[model samples]
Target: GRGFYSPSDATKWVAYESEPAQLLTIGLGVGLFAGGLGVMLGAPGVFLAFGITAASLVFLQFGVAVPVSHHIALPAAIAAAASGSVIWGGLVGVACAFVGEFMARTFLCHGDTHIDPPAAAITVMTTVVNAAAAFGFFALAKLPA
Candidate 1:
């Protein structure tokens, strides 16, 4: 029920939809703050922070009446949910944590100013995942009934 979209109303899942141009832009805005935190926190601290965020998202999805498909900050978790497996969502969430930290250390950490690792990571992962979804890569993953 709280999933991306029910089979009957598939239009609700607009996580990567480029038409409105809101979710991606919102991610960038949120990323500015998240990246600042990453720069201030350093190392696994930022990674752990994102992990908790992702976990909270999962909780919100399962525990509450929320849909995370439009959340670009946690693209991996979104992808996992699109794949129709909450377990996979948890695993992907952790892996995505590593990517956020890695992106921070590689791109943002070395820079003199805050480049925003979470933003960069989200952009990269979201593009790839959305592209895959566009190509029907996730078409095989049955939506729950």
Candidate 2:
């Protein structure tokens, strides 16, 4: 017997999963994973320094089903970490500041100003970094404990 299978059927697919718990758990796991990657790459401080600050912005502005952005800050962070120098953090921070400012002016400040360029940039950059970090860290973590 053929029945009327509506689009709403798809929406009801995950009815058993709690949305808030799912979102929070995923967010927390991602935060910890990203932070851990920063730490493992020889930059212990980056977990708090850049991880919290940059990753938050990226997650909020461009995470999930969004247009995506410039948050590819991991490489810079990795370099900074490898250097074992606070000076490197300062340098990368300054560079990111300039990039954020330029993005704000060139994109966010136009017309209705609906989008936040700095946040978008940071978010997208971090997203790419996180993806790379996840894969890289996964490979490293799988080295048989």
Candidate 3:
């Protein structure tokens, strides 16, 4: 049975998928930085602020389920709710922002070539976050199957 319409099993489907917050959080950080891409600019810091705000809101909205917070707009309105994953995901987003800016300054700005800092940050942080999750560092983020 798909159990989609059943109230008791409504959330069962999430078990088959990877956590949703990870990609979108990364997206928020990367997209924002990419939009405001600049050398030593305030984009990363803004990204950081978003991370804290979004995740903390998740901590507040225990009804929506933190993993459900894939959009940056949610935090502004109802937000992710709770679930430990939200905070960790927020940290990941913030980390991506910090790293993206750092990469931009260290590798892109001083160099003559155009290496996308957001792209690099996304790639590296994706791997790092997943690796940490696998190692039980952020295991709470995973939905139970």
Candidate 4:
């Protein structure tokens, strides 16, 4: 009599568990570091930066299932995060200036757009530049450092 026999072995499953935990820890640590740097340089809020990086990494993990799609998706997430941060920061700066100008004019009658626009523009430029530079530095730096 020939019957299908299944081997009951739990040893392989136990070994597999440890490696994934270590890998996940390493990935999270790296993501946190990268995201923290982005926030420090005014790229974006810490949560946004970490979310973007984590999403990108998660997309990339499916490289085998859809190789080309994963390749395109990861970079797209990074770029979108960087550009969005720059634009959002810039808009916030401009809005703040407008509010400040309105308050000043109402209270002190001395504020004007003649100076506010330029100041806002500079703020936007500075925020964008700093964000880009921080991103570049991280890309070129040694990993896990």
The C-alpha TM-scores of every prediction are 0.43, 0.37, 0.40, 0.22
Q: Compared to the true structure, candidate 1 yields what TM-score?
A: 0.43
Each prediction's RMSD over C-alphas, in Å, is 18.6, 15.9, 19.3, 22.7
Instruction: Enumerate residue pairs that collide in model 3.
Output: 58-81, 61-81
The CA lDDT at 47 in model 1 is 56
RMSD in angstroms between candidate 1 and the native structure over all alpha carbons: 18.6
- TM-score-better candidate, 1 vs 4: 1
**For residues 13-78, could you state the per-residue lDDT of candidate 3 as single tens digits?**
222212345444544553333223211233353345446544654654665444322223222111
Candidate 4 per-residue lDDT over residues 1-145, each given as its tens digit: 3212211233221122123343244323433343344434433543454454446546546652211111111222232345433323323333333333333233333333334322343344445435654778424432331
Q: In lDDT terms, how accurate is model 4?
A: 0.34
Instruction: Say which prediction, candidate 2 or candidate 3, comes out ahead on TM-score.
Output: 3
**Residue by residue across 1-145, what tens digits does model 2's lDDT show?**
3222221323321222213354234333333343344445655555444555554556555434321212323434543444433333333344444444445445544334456654665665556444645576434433211
Query: What's the CA error at residue 144 for candidate 4, in Å?
Result: 18
The regions of model 4 sitting more than 4 angstroms off are: 1-28, 31-35, 38-43, 57-61, 64-145
For lDDT, the strongest prediction is 1
Worst 10 residues of 2 by lDDT: 9-18
Q: Name every residue pair that clashes in candidate 2.
A: 58-123, 69-124, 70-125, 71-124, 71-125, 71-126, 72-125
Off by over 4 Å in 2: 1-44, 51-77, 123-145
Tell me the tens digit of each residue's lDDT in model 1 across 19-93. Answer: 223433434443433333333444343454356555655766565643232233356444543454443343344
